[model samples]
Every structure is written in C-alpha cells, then in structure tokens.
Target chain A: MSQKTILNDSHRALGAKMVDFGGWDMPLSYGSQIEEHHAVRRDAGMFDVSHMTVVDLAGARTREFLRHLLANNVDKLKAPGKALYSCMLDETGGVIDDLIVYFLEEAFFRVVVNAATRDKDLAWIRSQAAAFDVAVTERPELAMIAVQGPNARARVATLLSPEVAAKALKIGKFVAFEGDGLFIARTGYTGEDGFEIIVPEGEAVALWQRLVDAGVAPAGLGARDTLRLEAGMNLYGQDMDESVTPWEAALAWTVSLDEGRAFIGREALEQQRAAGVPREMIGLVMDEKGVLRHGQKVLTEAGDGEILSGTFSPTLGKAIAFARVPAGAGSSLRVDIRGREVPVRIARIPFVRDGKPFDAA
Target chain B: MSEIPGDLKFMKSHEWARVEDNGTVTVGISEHAQGLLGDLVYVELPNVGDTAQAGQAAAVVESVKAASDVYSPVSGEIVAVNEALADKPETINEDAYGDGWIFVVKLTNREELEELLDPDAYAEAIENEED
Candidate 1:
C-alpha cells in the first residue's frame, strides 16, 4: 500500500487526481494544470508538502556533525532561523540527497529532505552521527504546507497571530521563525516569494482549509513540477541520483572545499575537480516549436547528452530544460525528439528567476 | 460528464471515431483519455496524407507530467490534422470529444471498422479495465 499524506481526504474532496509519487499517494492536479501554474505565477497558491521528511538533529555536536556530513558549509548560518541548501554525498561523491538545513540553536537544527530519500537519508545521517553524539529524530507528526506566489506571504499573514505575523513578515529570504507550535519559513521550491509552514499534523488540515478560504489557490504536484523546473531546481531522482555527482550535476556552487571542512566526498570532489569533470549540466531552450522532455538525446558538436528535466513554461510561454552534456559542449545544440533534430540554445541554469526571465536567455 | 454519443465508434485505446457520411472518420482522443492525461502542453500530429495502421502511433500528446502516444484505432490515410493544437494543446483537456478532434482519416478498409467497439461497449470496456 502507498502512504497517504494527512491532506489526502482534502485533496479528494477538492477533486484532485491522485497518483503514486515515489511511494506517496499525492495529488497530481486539481483541474487545469496550466491555470494552477498561472495562479502561483500571478497570484497565490498552496501545496501540501507533508510527504517530505523533516528530521530534527539535537545534541552538543549537532553543528559539527552537519559540517562533516553536508557538501555546503553550515558555518554560514550564524544566526538562528537561517537555512542552508546543501547536498549530502556518499564517499564516492555521488549525491545521496539534496536538502535544506535550518540552524536554530547550538543544540538543535532541522533538516528537510526529499520524501523518496527519507529512509536512506535518516540511516546515513544516523550512521555518520555516531561519533558526534547527535540524535536524529524524524518528525512525521509535523505537516508542511508551502504557500507561494507574489501575494503568498500577505495572505498567510492574515491567518497568523499578530506577533507571529510580524515575525514572518520581517523574516528575510531563506529564514524561518517559530511560534505557537508553528514553524514558518520564508522558503519555497517555486521561484516565488512565500512561506513553507510546518505545523502539527493534527492542525494541518484546518490550517490548509484556512489558507484555501483566504483565496490561496490549492495547487498540486503538476504545477509544483513546472514551477520548480522553471526555477531551475533539481528533482531528486531525475536531476541527480546515487549514480551522479554534485559537480557534474551543476551543483558545484553548493559544495564547500574552502578549507578546514573535511566533509564526506570532499576528497573525491577535489580529485574530480583536479581531473576535469566529464559532463556539465546546462539549461536548454527550444528556439522553435517543441517541448523539451527528459531522456531526449541532446546533440552537440562536442558530444551527445540527454535531458534531465524539461517542461513547458507557462510563465515564458515556451519550453525549457536542463540537459547534461559534454564539458566542452557549445552554447548551441540540437535535441533529437522522435527522430527529429530540433535546434536548442544552451542557456544558463534558470530560464526564469525572481518572477522575470533570467537575463542569460 | 457528458454522454458518449451513440453514433460514434470507439477504440480500446480510448479514441472516438465518428464516421462521416462521406466515408471519412473524424478522430479524437476520448474524454476519459484526456482526463487521464491531466493537462496537455504539446501535441505532435501526423501530417495529412500519412499512412497510419491500426495500433500504430498516430500522434503524441504531452502533459505536464509525461508524454503519451495516441494510437491509430483504424488503418487509413490521414486526411486532415488539427493545426489548432500547435498553439493550444489544452483544447484536448477542454473538449476531447469536439473541438479537440485530432484528425480525420479516409478509411482504407471500411471492413476493418467492425473491429472497433461502439459507444456503449467502449464504456463497458473502459469500466472493466478500471476494475
């Protein structure tokens, strides 16, 4: 049997089409996916992100444990409620999972990982924490909802207590605030200004309903996928997996090899950096009419590559994708779709950013 | 949900074909097929005069989640392809039985039409598949 989120009933009640997404029974869409995509781009939308795993690390050595575990440096988060995006890799430098780690206090920190990598991530974190004495506790009792868009923060603030609302409003990007059993973070997967609220699982449905009543449109996985792709965010298994390394997957910026940090896979990354990485991930936009899709063969003068993630951008009214190609691949390439070679331009990572088209295109 | 008009013949793959008095069959993916596909973003249709065999891929429908192949229900030569889908593929989601019609095929063998399911039998076939 597939695992269902706490909002499964609410999704069905709203006429959402449910699908099995990486073992979690989740809503794929409520109605028109394009409309849902536009809602987040133009107005406000909410997503039930309860399926993602939240693990709290608590102990005197929590910070030190994370420093040795993550590819990105946790030392950058000096202040409480600050979050860092990092990838945890294995000894071979293959990405185990990409996650957001929130630094709360010296003894407590929160890590949100992908839903499909929950079990393996917990196991890996626990095993690595053996020497640090940190305790890893999965918070399955907490439910997460992401309210994103231009007006997302304002709409959610209307439902919060005055003090909490003030704190949320004042919170900067990539920051979080906790109050009254609610953890509100100014973070989101979509390239939109919003908050990802984590509340008690029992109170989640009611909060979701309140958001719905506040004119926050309920979106599903379909819109979420398109939004994330437009933002150039990587999907766990599709963009990179156990077989792929962070440096080759266009995540070299997330890796910290500055010094004094001996994290897992550091040596391997250093070695790979010394020896030039084989494949580099790039963004591709079809100049003509065609939808870029995963597994499509990318033809470059240097060598051939394949698309990692692709979709039609409702915001841009065009198709875009991230493709892994030869390191020397030029800025222009062709994609073979159903035996037709279509010209594609090798643009920068994000086709759109900050509610506008990325300047690279 | 709207009724499946009796005059239309159906394919097991969820394509509805309405045989015009002129012997050409208008083809469109069924409402059930479109509903299952969620929202279509891109559609690749066969060109006019292309030969399509039964069970062969005749068109491509891409949704936000994944791409699916629309199979030819009956063998024939493509008479017309919906050019409107090039700009508005979501028409399949809006009117799978009407404006979203994919193409028209001039039947090469009218006798092969007997292999297709009628509207009522098509509904039953779909229900059984769901079960």
Candidate 2:
C-alpha cells in the first residue's frame, strides 16, 4: 500500500485525481492541469509537499558533521535561519540526492530531502554521523504546504497572525522563521515569490482549509513538475542519479571547494575536474507542434545523447527539455522523435520566469 | 460524467465512430478519453491511403503529461484526416465529437462496426472501469 499524507482525505474531498508518486499516494491534479499551472503563474496556488522527508540533526557536532556530508559548504550560512541547497554525493562523486539544509543553530540543523530517496538518505546520514555524534531524527509529524506564485505570499499572509505575518515579511529570500508551532520559509521550487510553511500534522487540515477559503487554488504534482521545470530546477532521480555527477548535471555551482574542508566526494570531483568532464546538460526548446519526451535520442555532431527530462512547458507554450550531450556538442542538435529527425535549438537553462519567457525577459 | 452520443458507435478503448452519408466512417476519441488525457498539445493522424485494422493503433495524441494511442474501431482505408489538428490540437479538448473528428475512413469491412459496442454498452464499459 502507498503511504498517505495528512491532506489525503481533504484532497479526495476536493475531487483531486490521485496517483502513486514515488510510493506515496499523492494528488496529481484537482481538475484541469493547465488551469492549475496558470493559477500558479498568474495568481496563487498551493501544493501538498508533506511527502518530502524532513530530518533534524541536533548535537554539538551537527555543523561539523554537515561540513563533511554535503557538497555545498554549510559555513556560508552564517545567519540562523538561512538555507542552502546542496547535493549529497557518494564517495565516487555521484549524486545521491539534492536537498535543502536550514541552519537554525550550531547544534540544530534541519534538512529536507526527496521523498523517493528518504530511506536511503536516512541510512546514509546515520552511518556517516557515527563519528560526529550528531543525532538524526526524522520528523514525520510535520506537514508541509508550499504556496507559490506572484500573489502567494500576500494571500497566505492574510491567514496568519499579524505578528507572524510581520516576521514573515522580514524573512529574506532563502530564509525561514519559526513561531506558534509553524515554520515559514520564504522559498519555493517555482520561480516566484512565495512561502513553504511547515506545521504540526494535527493542524494541517485546518490550515489547508483556511488557505482554500482564502482563495488559494489547490495545485498538485502535475503543476508542480511543470513549474519546477520552467524554473530550471532539476528533478532528483531524472536529472541526476547515483551514476551521474553534479558537473554533468549542470549543478557545479552547488559544489563548494573549500581549501581545508574534506567533504565526501571531494577527491573524485577534484580528479574529474583535472581530467576534462565528458558530458554536459543543456536546454532544448522546440517551437514546432510535437512534444519532447524523455528517452528520446539526441544526435549531436560530437556524439549521441539522450534527453533526461522533457515536457511541454505550460508557461512557454512550447516543448522544453534537458539533454545530456557530449561536452563538445554544437549548439544545434536533432531529436529522433519516433523515426523523424527533428531539429531543436539549444537554449539557456530556464525557459520561463516570472510568467514570461526567460529569453524575452 | 462525459457525454456519450447515442447515435454513434464506440469501442471499449474509447474511440468513437460515426458512419457518414458517403459510406465513409468518421472517427474521434471520446470526451472521457480527452479528459483523461488532459489538454492535448499534438495530434498525429494516419496517412490518407493507410489501412487501419480494427483494434490497432492508428493515430497518436500527446498531452503535456504523456502520449496516448488512438486505436481504430473498425477496419478501413484512411480517406481524409483533419489536418487542422496539426496546428490546433486543442480542438479535441473543446469539442471531441464535432469539430475534433480525427479522420474519415472508407470501411473495408462494414461487419466490423457491428462487433463494436453501442452507446449503452460503451457507457456500461466506462461504468465498470470506474469500479
């Protein structure tokens, strides 16, 4: 049986189409997916993201443990509530999962990881934390809701207490605030201004009801995927995996090479950097009719590659995809759609931003 | 619930057929199929002279989520296709029965249409699927 979130009953009551997503019963859409996508891009939308795993690390050696665990240096997060996006890699420099870490204190750091890789990540963290004496605790009693879009923050603020709203307004981008048994972060996967709020499981239904009554449209995993893709955010399993490195996944910026911090996967990355990287991820956009799909072979002048993540971008009104190609591949490429070799142009990472085409903006 | 046109024939796979006055059969997917597929972004129709076998894949419809096959409800030779769908595929979502007809086929075996489901049987099929 698939696991259910706290909002499962509510989703069913709202007439959502439920599907098994990564072993969890989650809502795929409330109704028309395109309408939900437009709701987030133009107005406000909310998503039930409680399926993601949240782990709390508490101990004197928490920061020390994280310094050696993550590819991104956590020392840069000087502020208490600041958050950093990083990838947990294996010893051979392959990505295990991309996650977000919030530094609440020297001894109390919180990390949120992908739902599909939760058990593996927990086991890895526990085994690695043996030497550092960090206590790893999985907080399953918390429910997360991500309200996103241009007016998301404002609409959500209307439901919070005045004092909490004031504090939330002051929370900088990539930062979070906690009060009244709620943690509100001014961050989201969609390339829009919003808040991702985590609350006690008991309070989840009431909070979701209030948000729905406040005119926040309920979007689902369908819109969430399109929004994140349009934002140039990579899906964990599709874009990168245990066999793929951050350099090939177009996530080299997330890796921090401090002079003295010997993180896991550092040696392999260093060796790969000395030797030239072979494959690179690039964006492909097709203005024509057909949609670009995953597993489609990409033929480049240098070599043959395959599409990692492909979809029809709702915001851009075109097909967009991320393909792994030879490092020396030219800007022009062709995708074998069924049997036809269709020409595609290489574009920048983000196809759309702020409800407009990124290239046009 | 999606509308089921009583005057037309339907296959369990969700393709609908209407026998035209010219003895050619007009084909399109049902409203339930379009709703399940979401907003279609592309439609690939069969060639004008291709032979379509009953219960075989004849066309392709793609939405943002994934691609789905549109099966032939009866054996026929493709006579004409709605070429407008190549540019404006959303017509299927708007009107799955009227302006969204996929193609017209000259029936090679008229007896195959009798083997397909009637409106009541198709409705029952959709109802049983829900359970």
Candidate 3:
C-alpha cells in the first residue's frame, strides 16, 4: 500500500487524478494539466508537495557538518533563514540527492529533500550526522504547499497577518520567514516568484482551502514537473543519481572546491576537473510539433547520449529537454525519437523565467 | 465517469470502433482511455491509404508525461484521419466519441467487429483493470 499525505483526501475531494509517486499516493492533476501549467506561468497555482521530506539538523557544529556533507559551500549563508541549493554527493563524487538547506542559526538548519530519495537520503544524512554529533530529526508532522506564479506570493500573503505578510513579502530571494504557525520560504522549484510554505499537518488542509479561495489554482505533480523543467531545475532521480556526478549533471555551479574544506566528494571532483570531464549536460529545444520524451537517443557531433528529462513546455508551446551528451558535442544535433532523427537546437536552460521565455546564456 | 457508448464496440486495449452507414468504420480511443492520457500535446496519424493491421499500432498520441500508441481496432485501408487533431489533440479529451474520432477505415474484414467487446463488457473490463 502507498502512503497518503495529509492532503490526500482533500486532493480526491477536488477531483484529483491520483497516482502512486515514489511511495505516496499523490495527485497527478486536478483536471486539465495544461490549464494547471498555464496557471503557474500566468497567475497562481498551489501544489501539495507534502510528500517531500523535511529534516532539521541541530548541533553546535551543524554548519561545519554541512560544509563537509554538501558539495556547495554553506559558509555563504551568513544570514539566518537564507537557503542554499546543493548536492549531497558520495565519496566517489556521484550525487546522492539534490536538496535545499535553510540556515536559521549556527545550531539549526532545515533541509528539504525529494520524497523518492527519502530512505537513502535519511540513511546517508544520519550516518554523517552521527560523526559530527549533530541531531537529525525528521519532521513528518509537517506538510508543504508550494504556491507559485507571478501572483502567487500576493495571493498567499492575504492568508497571513498584516505584519507577517509584510515581512514575508519583503524577505529577500531564497530566504524564509516564520510567522503564524508557518515557515514561509520565498523559494520555489518553479521559475515563478512564490512561497514554499511548511505548516503543521493538522492545518495543511485548511491552508490549502484558503489558497484556493484566494484564486490559487490547484495544480499537481504534472504541472510541477513541467514548471521545474522550464526553470532548468534538475530532478534527483531522473536528472542525476548515485552514479552521476554534479559536474556531469550540469551542476558544476553547485560545487565549491575551496582551499580548506575537504568535502566528501571534493577529491573526486578535483580529479574529474583536472582530467577534464568527459560528459556534459545540455538543454534541448524542439520547434517541431512533437513532444520530446525521456530515454530518446540524442545524436550529437561528439557522440550519442540519452535525454534526461523531456516534456512539452506550455509557456513556450514547444518541447524542451535536458540531454547529457559527449563533452565536445556541438550545437547541431538530432534526437532519434523512436526511429526518426528529429532535428533539435541547443538552448540555454532556464527556458522560462518570470513568466516569459528566457534566452539564458 | 467516462462514457461508454452502447452502439460502439470497444477493444480490451481501450480503442473504440463505430461502423458508419457507408460501410466504413470510425476509430477513436474510449473516454476512459483519453482520461488516463491527461491533456494531449501531439498526435501522429497514419497516412491516408495506409494499411492498418488490426491490433497493431497505426497512430500515436503523446501527452506531457509519455507517448502512447493508438492500436488499430480492425484491419482496413485508412480512408481518412482527423487531421485537425494534429493541431488540437485535446478534442479527444473533450468529445472522445464524436469529433475526437481518429481515423476512418474501409473495413477489410467485417468479422473483426464481432471480436470486439460490447459496451457492458468493455465497462467491466475497465473495472477489472482499475483493480
């Protein structure tokens, strides 16, 4: 049997089409997936992301522990409630999971990880925490709802007290503010401006209802996937796994190889960088009217590669994808979708930003 | 609640077939099938005059998640296809039994229609699969 979120029954009440994602029965869509996708791009949409695992790390040396555990440097988060996106890598430089860590204090940092990687992530996290004398506590009593879009923050703001809403809306990007029994983070997986709010389990359903009444469309995992893809966000399992490195996953920016901090995967990353990484991840855009899907063979100048994550972008009205090809592969490429070698152009990722098509460099 | 038209025949695989008065058969997926596929993004139709072997993939429909093969319900020569679906595939999700019809086939063997399950049988099959 699959696990159910606090909002599972609420989702069904709203006519959600549920699917077993990872081990949780989650909503795949409320109704028209395209409409939900458009909602996030244009106005506002809320997703029941309660299946995501939240872990709180507490100890005197929590910051030092994260410095050694994550590929990204945590020293950059000098201010409280600031979040950082990083990859938890193995000793061999392969990525274990990609996560968001919010530093509330030196002794306390909150981390949110993917639901599918819950077991392994917890195991790895706990094992490492024990050595650092840090307490790793899982907050299963919390539920997360990501209200995302240009108007998402404004819609969500109406739910909070006036002072709290003012502070939350004024919070810097990638920051969090807690008030009114909620942990509201000005962070989102979708490219849109929004909040990923964490609330106690008992209040999740009510909060969801308030957001819906505020005109936030009820979206699902389907819209979330497309939105994140357009934002050039990497999904942990599909985009990279234990056998893939951050460098090969188009996440070299996340790795910080400084002088002192010898992180878990630092040596391996340094070695790979010194020897020159053999594979590279690139973004794909198809102008033709066919949806590009995962596992499609991409034929490039240097060699061949498979698509990592591919989907139809509702905002662009075209197909977009991520493919890991040979390091020296040129922009001229063809993706063998089924049997036909369909032509595709390389695009700078974060295909859409702020509700419009982004020509990122 | 997806509708199962009593006059139409259904395949266990979810394709629906309706016989026209002119001795040709119209093919489309059932409402249940379209509901499962979510919103359609693209549709690949077989060419006119193409041979559609019964139970074989004669057309393709793609959603945001994945692409699905629309199996030919009966063996026939492809007489006409709903070309409008190439531009607006969501029609299937809207009126699957009517404007969403995929192709028109001049049936090569009318006996194949008898092999299809009736509406009641198809509904039962859907229930069984849902379990």
Choose the strongest candidate by DockQ: 3
lDDT of 2: 0.92
Number of clashing pairs, model 1? 0
lDDT tens per residue, model 3, B1-131:
66577789999998999999999999999899988999998999999999999999999988887799999889989999999998899898899999999998999999999999999999999999999
* Best first by DockQ, ranked: 3, 2, 1
Write the residue-wise lDDT of candidate 3 on A83-194 in tens digits: 9999999999999999999999889999999999999999999999998999999999999999999999899889899999999889999999789989999999999999
Residue-by-residue lDDT tens digits, candidate 2, A1-361: 9999999999999999999999999999998888999999999999999999999999999999999999999999999999999999999999999999999988999999999999999999999999999999999999999999999988988887899888887788999879767999998998888999999999999999999999999999989988888888999999999998999999999999989999999999999989999999988998776889989999999999999889988887888899999999997799999788999988887878778899712
Best by lDDT: 3
For all predicted structures, in order, the TM-scores are 0.98, 0.97, 0.98
Instruction: Kindly indicate the candidate among 1 and 3 with the higher lDDT.
Output: 3
**On residues B1-131, what C-alpha lDDT tens digit does candidate 1 reach at each position?**
46888888888889888889999988889999888888788899999999988778899998877788888877899999999999899898888988999989898888778988998899999899889
**Residue A210, candidate 3: how far off, in angstroms?**
1.3
